[model samples]
Target: MADDGLITIGALARACGLTASALRFYDDCGLLVPVRVDGATGYRYYSEAQVDRGVMIRRLRGIGVPLEAVAEIVDGDGARAERLLDAHVAELAERARAAAVVTRMIKEEIRAGAVLSAAALAAAIEQVRSAAALDREMPILAGVLVESSADSVTVTATDRYRLSTRAMVPVRPSGAAWSVVVDAGELGGIGSWLRGLDEVSVWSADDALILAGGGTERRCGVIDEAYPDYRAMLAGLAPVRTRVVVARDALLAALEDRGAAPIVFLADESGLLLSRDGSACIAATITGPRTELAFSPTTLRPALVSAIGPEIMLDIASADAPVVVRSATDGDLTTLVMPTAIMNSKENDA
Candidate 1:
């Protein structure tokens, strides 16, 4: 008995620094099973060799590995098990990086003694409302574009391939007019704090957009430059003959899980082709009569995903022209993306 390789469930649990119930729970979850069971007494016993495996299972589970995956690794080859752990490690690293960025931003805000203003809060909410599909890396350029009689505050951002545009209600301030740009991240952070407010006030001074209301004042820098003429870019496209209504969430889920690009919109009779350097040809379905234009996946997908409505309305010009995607409910926010081309011939010229 002293030399036996087996240990009682209680003893094993103590060795693993876990309770007996936890060990049983792990067995119930298929992560670990006792090596032998007493036929009549229904006693459970685990081999001493299983202690290390049990500890590892507990550690992996604590870190959020699914029970099924943990079982696969516990029973599979060492290399495959290591590969699984490595993938989890990489994911954790990404989460850590994102957390660090947020932590730093919070510390900065606290150090500056900044508070949110009514106008700034409203502008921030409007920014999210207008372009919810804008990429995080894309610069969120928001500011008041003031002219002689009217003042228009606009929020714009582009992932270089696709662009989004949103504008706030025009307000005529009784003073000289000028434009100021603000950082989108800072706006988003302050906006998060000032949720539930109906109106927010903002002022521009010392190259910063200041939000002052609710006894808190926060200052964020404004973006520089006149936002690109997105409106002009979207004008004069040929009418779209073919229109499709698709569920926004379904399409977005498919794209995120499978890396499937957005649906291609083509117009007129021109053929729109898709190909990668080492990938097979991608053919787009023809939903309506032929026309002359096409739109890029980069621009179309983000716009579609950002839409808050249940469905999206896709409209395209000819195969070579810009394609427009609009939220079924809000036509004011439109995304126009140019078509991409494939170069078939290989040539060398000095």
Candidate 2:
């Protein structure tokens, strides 16, 4: 008997290239449920739409993925699915390393570079690389400055208006310090691939920056230009006269759909008010005196999105000074977003 447009379990198994028994097991586990069931005979029927999901489950299980992990990958969000696959791949690599494979020993070459967690490197790159300038005249500003020292690895990028810097402790730091400016677009494009590996080694070779991990290496040409003295700029920041702590997501959402217009932020004892003609009040913990600061919503929103935690702290020296945005809990990433003029005080920076 035809079960409307639904296919029987045997047909679904055949369509998805899985055995009927395996489909029954997945059905019993609730990972893949049939669209309809004939209660009289207890026969299950699945829609054609479920064929793709069935094939995905079969493929994932064929690679030795556990039933529970496979279920998550099949049912979870894209990020969760990717993370599960990455963890499984890492586990397989560990198994290969543990295997007693016979091999001849060769002299190992000690490459001058820092070894760090691939996911950490990817996150740091995401946090800072957005600040790189896309100007054609200054090609050097189009790349991110990556520096490795005896203790830590740091990535910094700036577009003259805003600057973002993040530092992380390397798993194995090089004995000597090295620096290279790698193209931001190229580095950012491989962030997903990098996150799949356990560890990555980064070093400069001649005119290119080499990132090697998991038996794979990606080489990107280095810009032969002197980067701005960002460290000195950091050291010369003015004393903070006002500090405000606010919910990161709420503030980010407020900036959405506001267009490219500049938004005014008024911080006082009451709380914080965001206004760009239309006003919205957000509860925030305010420190210091009442202050009004205006900033381009496009420029300021990215800094908030790149912030780590739920709460973010803003330290402002004055109305026209750069505002430092840092996570309330994590201090590894710091972003300085320059403020624009409010109204008739100075020229609009928006």
Candidate 3:
């Protein structure tokens, strides 16, 4: 120590296991002030008492604490500093989750085969998992139809009332086209298996369908029976003349509150009217001539739940055809609903 009872910046830095430049920068930033400065030599010095402060500063920075935050702690408000640290910890945790998901998104090309997005596979599984059979009439409807082509793997499912389809891209197509229907009931807990993976490969054997991703493999029984021509149904959809757009959440809220009667959509000059029985329950704007179509909200809510975006557009195809619901922001997700025999408010009273 100098005769003035002050230690030179060099000595202080050595004692604190830090560099003199770091101390100088900290001093300039007002985080740690020097005890003394030589006017002619322009050298900085610290008192022996500042050893603890210097050690704290070095250790805090070593742990990734920002300088501004260190200054707050040095100024005598440790509680506020703790709060800031807690916030940082929370941010790191969220990033970890997102990173895990992204890491699983990397497509690992199949050996002598193509690559597929495992995350997208997981999403497709989720969309169609609930489309299994309601009764025992058609056992084939209880499975999910998955087909892979040159660039995509498409998953489709339907329970007669609604059909859900999702396409995953980056799939290396096979020279020979192949399709299979896997029991969707086996899809339970599949999402958990793909939480941290980036890519997956799919294959099939005599009676089983397999999905391998994130170092995990899952297999389920396949339905040998021919799946209904879902593609034909979608392709043959009738043209539409009226379209009503409503935000998904808003439409869901109105439909969910439909007392006891089936949900009805009445579209005229006064806008679209959503009703439970004969009376109007929720009012929304419609973009075409007078048209009212009724169907069970209980039956229709599932499609709305599956639809994406700030608003869902309802495409009315004549009076007897199915209505298509799609995301307004992006047309990626679509839900098709078959209209009920009941299409007017006057039929409810009788």
Candidate 4:
């Protein structure tokens, strides 16, 4: 509307889909200052070239981005802007997860109690217990997740690097589904006590897990924390490129010999080879193409030792992808072991 082809503040506001007053506020904040200001009437005007910038600022603010973040995103280079946006998104996700946990804690109700074999439940708990994280910042990962339904009870735990889960058929299934996360240290002690009992009846109420059996009852406080979406990670795994079935004890012994060093696994039609500078070979029933992967002995040995059967099966998607480990004869327990790196990276560096 200005004579020199500069648009008035009102026109720029309409073009950018923002109110005149909003534009004035941004101008005052030095975010979208107008191109010109009339000395006589104190009127603000913007150049046509500034319209795109105004629109971008409006869009950035629309997403609830704080002005400081918005300034970083709008005024910084592409990579810096991307990093800022990603950080903002991660913060939002964390906040949302916390909110969801609080809401569930307030509104959730436990419908029925579950009856399960005490020995089997205890074993399941021990199998996955080692996967719980010890991070002070993430107290949620310090607990094990237990979910019960009409048919089965499943326990799962993860320390970000690996995850283990076991599903057991209940002696008497709950009439309704329920879930709770109990601290791993407390659960381990409870499991030890439960091992002596024949059966245990468990239920959740008021954010606590109560187990009753043999004329004795014990209660453990449930963690009011948000757990990571491990199911999504499991479901999103790529198709297995190689599969191998090998003796669990033999593999466990080989890993034990490796001590704390990293181990590389090389699998082919002939068999599977385990190596850490020195090498040991185990006969295996292998399918698919030859594949090689590496893992920390500490990270993988527990998974083999905790398996229920004599033989363990591994499903590998890639050298770097998470390897699925389960018992060949009894698949009730499953573990995902994340590879440290490909063999080439280790051998070449060494």
Candidate 5:
């Protein structure tokens, strides 16, 4: 020891099991600056009491905390620092969970191999799509909503949260109008079949939607009742009265940063309100505000994340009603989101 209350930088590094260069880096970062520097020899010294904090800094950095975050942790109140750490840990956990699900799906697909029938594959695709939306508690449902006409065949699924409709026209098409509701699992099988071939033939028989593709056939049950009057819903929507040009990624990032789900819609005021824990609120600017209606960040964020568009157009009736979001690039895609009433603007002052 150099003195009763001090140690040379080298001694401190050895005691903390950190390289000298790492210590210097920490000092440079203001994370663990030495207490004194000798003017003559340029030697550095640290207080013995810094050993615990040094160890903590090393451990935090080992776990991949950025230098700036490490500085915040070191200087901030214990509770706030702990909250940041916990949030990061939670994010890691969510990512791990998502990875595990994908891994399991890949493994299952491998096990099934080419032996899996086309119908089975289509069904699998449908299920995965449903799982992605359902996991988020979005009310809209997805299925092989089949409609057969003399000219073409249409299969569609919409969450209303964010509408995505995919259609395939069979080459040797069945020219009949048929409506069916296939479970996600069954739709996955149909999706699998659809993938194997450029076209598929589908028919409804005995309450099942039968899809035949690449010589493999799959069948799924029809939904009991007609789908909600989706056409009527669309008709009820007011025309686009206001247009706001926003950078899709910037707005999306901001919403994600605030943990709000993105919803696309026209609002009376172009503004975003983020509500957390069901009460705390944060307000953000909507690129255009006067003509369009306002939307909750919670609803808009998810839609933005799911949107595959360079620009989104929102159509709204008023600030208090459901808003429709249409993709500028894709005319077929639409998203409908009900706005949460804003009783007081002060709630979202942040």
Candidate 6:
């Protein structure tokens, strides 16, 4: 009956420092259920692994978490659950503005004093911070997705018009394999805080993420909605019909120089063209077939800015297909620009 990796309901309650009545209430409410039950004896048994979840449930209830919200968190919808907690934290902050009430109390209980821990390189965080969708049309795009696999983590963002990604290996290798869509602003805060450090470690609770390092501990909310299938979008891309290499700085400068003019793009056998008001043109040398693609400058500039390298490859399949942008220096990075046509004249650009 002892140390068999399974325990009676009473033992589980005691193990998590909760009382029998409270556990029974939680079970009845459909929040946490025992792993096994002895129907004949009318007794329940819980798995040892569930101890952490039980403790989390107890702490959440103590803080006045609503029954529905608590179930959301317990059921692995932490992002949505975290948003509810954040509302509670905001109310608490207004009342106790100077105190670390939410930060200290919730972090300790959620972590159970064991240091909820995961690590990622600072370089990757910066990439995600920069790529966060600025346009608010798709609210969920406002966050960066941090996805972990057995050997790597990918940080990505998109704005429907443009997509950016950075993939890298984690430093500590915890194999926790957790994924979350975190607010772009929060991610930027993390990257800024970790600027001088080579690496950073973060811990996630059901409703919040505790960032700990450099004598600074802060809590931020997790995004609740499901992230878009950006990986699928990036996977089987259109064929590259015209792949031309140009200096990243040159292309960005060209895009930047178009002032007070209808932005236009003309890619031909000689070069890529950017012209404003038919006054002058900025040309990036190219060695591809003559291809005229018309799209707004706003749709493409982000990819050029993110490339940040000596050379950039603009992969184009047709006038209507998405164009792929790549940095010559970093192969692991990529940005895709969705093609669009102007209302007035696609012919004028060509």
Candidate closest to the true structure, highest lDDT: 2
Model 2, 1-350: lDDT tens per residue? 25488889999988999998988888899989998888999898998999999999989988889999998888889999999999999999888766624221111123468889999999999999999997757888898999988899999999988899999999988667889998888886889989889999887777888898999989988888999999998889999999999999988887785678788888987788886333688899999988899999878988998999999999999998889999999999999999998874343334
Look at candidate 4 and give me any clashing residue pairs.
none
Question: What are the lDDT scores of the predictions, listed in order?
Answer: 0.57, 0.87, 0.75, 0.86, 0.58, 0.69
lDDT of 6 by residue, 1-350 (tens): 33556788888888888998888888898877887777788777888888998899888888877788788877867687778899877877686864577677765554432221233345555544565678677778898776755566677888777788877655544346667777787766565566655545555567665567667676767788899898788677776777777787776776676553445566765466664243444456665576666666766765676664689888888877778788767776777877776435554555
Ranking the candidates on lDDT from highest down gives 2, 4, 3, 6, 5, 1
How many clashes (backbone N, Cα, C below 3 Å) per candidate? 27, 0, 6, 0, 35, 0
Worst 10 residues of 6 by lDDT: 112-121
Q: Between 3 and 4, whose TM-score is larger?
A: 4
Off by over 4 Å in 4: 1-111, 276-278, 343-350
Evaluated at residue 72, the lDDT of candidate 5 is 85
RMSD of each: 26.2, 23.8, 20.0, 21.5, 28.7, 18.1
The TM-score values for the models, in the order shown, are 0.45, 0.67, 0.62, 0.66, 0.48, 0.59
Question: Order of all candidates by TM-score, from best down to worst?
Answer: 2, 4, 3, 6, 5, 1
**lDDT of model 2 at position 277:** 33
Error of 1 at 17 (Å): 88
Instruction: For residue 286, give model 1's deviation from the true position in Å.
Output: 10
Please give the RMSD of candidate 6 to the true structure. Answer: 18.1
Per-residue lDDT for 126-205 in model 4, tens only? 89999888776788989999889889999999998889999999998987888899888888688778987999987787
Candidate 4 vs. true structure, TM-score: 0.66
